[model samples]
Target: MKKTVLVFGLLILALLLMFQFSKYAVISGDLKVELIVASIAIVFFFIGVYINKKTLQKPNTPIEEISHKRIKELDISNREYEVLQKIAEGLSNKEIAQSLFLSESTIKTHVSNLLVKLDAKRRTQAVKKAKSFQIL
Candidate 1:
């Protein structure tokens, strides 16, 4: 955070200096108004490009492969796995039922089974265990 603040502070200071220099040049008639404006615009364009490059950079992370063998070993059925994925997405039982076109009670049963298979006490813990097992 401190490093970001410092970098931004320096950029602002440089921009202020450039503006002051342009103002002085205009007042003294040492530079043409059009030339000054063009130079400032060019500087601003480069600054925008720099900021975009810095802020829009995505981290390179390896994609994790789901373990089908682990899922089979855990005895989680396809429908139960689907319900588990929905639960991992933070969906409610009613929402999961609606999305899957199943009854809410059925969704609840799948969740219960997932909890037992994952040996988890809660939905979040079940999801965490599933990820740790590479089944999610």
Candidate 2:
């Protein structure tokens, strides 16, 4: 914690120094317009980086783009498919059970079976794979 505070303090001090130096340089005409342009370019570079990161975080796969071959090959049961749809809708086991008129344990079993069929270790992963396969 102390190390973190120390580092942050140093960074703050450096920024203050840079700001004062830049103010002096600009007033003295020591900083050129080229430097201003370069700073703008750097700001835009960081903005582009942030936008690219956000874009990459979201998948762009449309439903029409998802292949159906693996979906057909998986041959999931009708009930399992229903459970998968509920999972895709972001329902919890208890909610799914209530909606489907089944016990929570039964819903859990179906979720487990669906995971095995989809070869996924987590519920979210199973749903993503199912969507990618156009099964949901």
Candidate 3:
């Protein structure tokens, strides 16, 4: 925070000095008005470019690979995994059933089986465990 304040303070001071120099040059007829305006515009353009490069660049994070072996070890079926993914997306059992074209009872059964297989007491816990195992 202190560094940011110091940098901004320096920038403001530099801009003030430039403006004062431009004013003196204009009064003394040493520099053209168009030249002073162009110089200020160029400085602002560089400042904008620097800010964009610093704040808008994306971080280079590698994607995590899913653990198919862990899924197999947990004996989670494809359909159950689909249901688990839907649950992780904050979907309710009815919504999962609708999306998967399965009955609500079937969805409930899959959820219960997932709870037992993942040794989780709740849906959130199951999702958390699945993420920890890198199987989701």
Instruction: Please report the candidate that would top TM-score against the real structure.
Output: 1
Q: Per-residue error at 134 for model 1, in Å? A: 1.8
Clashing pairs in 2: none
Off by over 4 Å in 3: 1-34
- Per-residue lDDT, model 1, residue 29, is 93
TM-score of 1: 0.87
Residue-pair clashes, model 2? 0
Score every model by TM-score. Answer: 0.87, 0.50, 0.72
Judge candidate 1 at residue 9 and give its lDDT: 94
lDDT of each: 0.94, 0.80, 0.94
Q: Model 2, 26-124: lDDT tens per residue?
A: 889989767855775675576568657865796776547544566568977778888898999999999999999999999999999999999999999
Which model is ahead, 1 or 2, in terms of TM-score?
Answer: 1
